[model samples]
Structure formats: structure tokens, C-alpha cells
Target: MPKAELGSTYWNNRYISGKTGWDLGEASPAIVAYFASQRNKDAKILIPGCGNAHEAEALIQLGFTNITLIDISEELVSTLQSRFAKNDSIHVELGDFFEFSGTFDVVIEQTFFCAIDPALRSKYVHKMHQLLNKGGKIVGLMFNREFPDGPPFGGTQKEYKTLFSGKFNTKMDECKRSISARLGSELWVQFDKI
Candidate 1:
């Protein structure tokens, strides 16, 4: 099969056509479960490429006050602005993740990394390093299996290690037992800024 086009236009069209298969419709179980056990309510959290931002809502319910969400799609961001209008705790922005600037204590990655062009993997890692404060962490799932075609590009543990090593320390990069269907072939990763 030929690879599908996957640029800003492609992703924007996906949002316009409501073809967002990546949206879980709720906070991811792995993410919710992980943060549920934490007691910090003041952590500076960021969720780039935060489509629909279900996790942001969940975080607000958990009493986390400082949350920021960024996405490149104007349509999605517009919808999100309205959806979160009454909620003052979240800061939503429409922008490229690479050019987004901020310091965060925790960055949540869901489907963001896989959605980017595979050639930008190094830039993604570097940007993550730059966006995080020292000792800050990024925790989320990553595709552990290779897709025959992608945007939703898949990767192996070795590939992730090579991509993040030297720049960050791996706290966890193991299979997530509670992932949704079709995502059984994924790994949960937690990278701490070195």
C-alpha cells in the first residue's frame, strides 16, 4: 500500500472530516491511572498535540490547576476553545509543537509523536528536552510495533532508546498492560530530563 500523505494539511483534513481515529474519547486509562496515584496538584503540565484534551479535563477534575494544551489544527483548537471556555484552568493554543515554547514539569505524550513525520523524531526528542525543566518528565505511550504504513508511524524499543539516549534518561519504556484495542502493540514510556 502507498503511504498516505501526513502533513499539516492531512491532519487538518482529518479533523475537519472527523476522521480522528486516534482520539480515545476519554482520558487514556494508562494516563489516568498513573496520575491518579500522584498527590501533586500544582505540577506544571503540558499536553502538546492535545486533540480534544480529555486528559486536560481529567486533570482539572483531579485538582491540577496549571495545564496547557497545544495542537496545530485550527479546527480542533477552535472546538477545544469553546469546549473549555468555562474552564479557566487550561491554556489551549494553536501552534506547531516544534515551535511551541514553555517550561513544564510534566509533558504528556499520547499519539503526538507517532503522528509527526518519522524524519522529525530527533527534532521531537530535542524539542521535548528543551521544553522540559531539568528533572522534568514526559510520560505516555508509544507505538512499539512498526506499521506497514503510518502517521501513526510505529517504532521499536531499541529505536526509542537510540532516539532519547544521551538527551534524556529513561525511567520506563515497557509494554502497557491496559492499553485500548489495536494499541496492544505499544509501550508505556516515562523519560526524565537529565
Candidate 2:
């Protein structure tokens, strides 16, 4: 976990200073592939801590109809709301994700998990449970490695499995389709609220 609480102000400054190394500029291919396989175009999907939201863009491209994006950074969400203003299929809101509320059939986890303070991992698990409908699942990529210091606090599958154990039906596999640079370090994670 970070010595300082990784909060709205900290994240806002990251974007302002252009320190967003986590902004992939495009959707993670593995995640996009998963979206491509989803048959329901109208599934209610939420992307928390959504940065730049390339995955949301991909979801729109793939014909998804209801996508919600929430983030703590006002600067980023303002730009996002403006960016998607004309699109009814995507909704952008500026707020702390932990306090944000909505129920969804699917939650997309891109780099968001790694970006949170590790000490809040269990809180994250509880929040996700509350946000999802029964049988609804969270699917996307997570780091399978560790970072020296981070907003991108990394973790191994063992930790994740333990964290989610009683609350979800979890499945994780080494992500086979991660973009070249991230391929080896990523895991494809799916956790259905149990």
C-alpha cells in the first residue's frame, strides 16, 4: 500500500502531470476479446476507476448498450463526460468509486484493481459484491506480479483467491492475449458474486 492514501487529489495530479503510465491508450486486447464474446448487448456494465476508458470505447464498438464509468478524478471524468456526451450508451460520473452506487450485470476490471491501495483489497471485494447482481461477474485483467511502490500495487493469484474466496466463485488464468509488453504479467480474472 502507498504511504499516502491514494485518493482523488493524488489521482487528479497524476493526470495533470501526465504521469499516467497505466493509460494503455487502447483497450487491453484480452479484455476486448472477452467483451467480443459476450452475447448480450444490453448487459448493465460498470467500470470503476475507469481511466481514459478505452475498454468502454471497445464495448461501445462491440455493440454494448449500457455502460457506466466512474472515477475519483474530477479532471478526468469531466473530460470523459464531454468525450462521451453524444453517446447514450455510455454514462460517465465523477466520484469516489467506493462510495459510488449502482447495480450491474457485469463489471469490467482493467488496471483499476492494481491502481488501488492494497490495504483496501477486502473493502474492494465487498464493494464489488454490493455492486453486482447475483450471478453477475467481474471480468478483466489484473497484475500477476508485484511492484516496488505503486498506485499499481500488484499481487499474486494466491492473495486474490484468498481475498475473494467465500464471496465469489473465482477463476483466474494467465492472460494469453495481453498486449505484448503486459502478456506475461497479467491474469485473466473472473469473479461471480456467490
Candidate 3:
């Protein structure tokens, strides 16, 4: 597919057709554990490329008060807006993450990074830095292996470190608690904006 074709329309159609293989049906275990470990429940958090937003639900249940979710897919965002309409703590926006601006204490990364083309990796890192407050963190998983074809583009720790280390302090480890399908293949990353 052409790079341009991978924009909002491609993703919206995925949602429209229920082609979301990336939806884990619930919040990712590694992410949930990280959130559970946080002492502050009111930290400002952002979840970009937030399809289905299972993490938002987890955050709400954990007493988190400020959360933002963004997705390029109109269909997905519309559904999420309605799904979260009655909740005052969560804000859902339909837009591109690179263009969306907000300062967050924590940004949750699930399958979002891998969903983008690999060539945009540097842009993704820069945007994450822009979206964070000083000492803010990005906590979640990244695929540790490669895929033959990808919407699920994968990368190694070396690449991730090289991409994020200049702008952030980075730590990565095998995620033992990953959901079965991703077990052993997922790397839990903590990238702190310096």
C-alpha cells in the first residue's frame, strides 16, 4: 500500500470492517501493571492511536481523572466519543497524533508505535517528546521481533534505544506478563523525557 493510503481512510475502513487484529479485547497486561503501580491517580495521560481504548477504561477504573485518547479513524473515534460521553474525566479526539498537542505526565504506548510506518519512527519519537511535560514518561510495550508484512511493524531494542535515547532516558526489558499471544515477543519500555 502507498504510504499516503495508510492515513485516516485506511484505518477508518479497518474499524468499519472489524479488521482490527491489534485489539487485544482488553487492556494489555503490561500496561495495566504499570498503571497499577503508579501512586498518583490523577496524572495527565495520553493514549495515541487509541483504538478500542481498553487502557482508558482501565485507567478510569483505577481512579485516574485526566486522560486523553486520540485516533485517526473517524469510525473508531465516533464510537469512542459516544462510549465515553458520560464520563467527564476522559477526552476523546479524532485527529492525527503528530498534529495533536497536549502536555501529559504519562503517555501509554500499546500497539500504537508499530501501527505506523517504520520510516516515521523518528517523527514519532519527536512528537512524543513534544507531547510530554518535563520528566514525563512513556510506558508500555513494543514488539521485539519483526513481521513479514506489517501494520504491526516491529523493531528491536537497539533501534528503539537509538531512536529515543537522545531525547529521553530509555529502559527496555522482556515483558513476562504479556498476554499469551504476545508473550516473549514483547518488550516493556520506559522512555523518560529528559
lDDT of 3 by residue, 103-143 (tens): 99999999889989888899999999999999899999999
As a TM-score, model 3 comes out at 0.98
Q: TM-score of the candidate numbered 2?
A: 0.97
Best by TM-score: 3
C-alpha-based local distance difference test score of model 1: 0.86
Q: What is the C-alpha lDDT of each candidate?
A: 0.86, 0.91, 0.92
| Candidate 1 vs candidate 2, lDDT winner | 2
| 1 versus 3: better lDDT goes to | 3
**23-94 in candidate 1: lDDT tens per residue?**
888888888888888788888999999998999988888889889999988889999999888887899999
RMSD in Å for all candidates:
2.1, 1.1, 0.8
Candidate 1 residue pairs in clash (backbone atoms < 3 Å): none
Predictions ranked by lDDT, top down? 3, 2, 1
Model 2 lDDT at residue 77: 95
TM-score of 1: 0.93
Q: Judging by TM-score, tell me the better candidate of 1 and 3.
A: 3
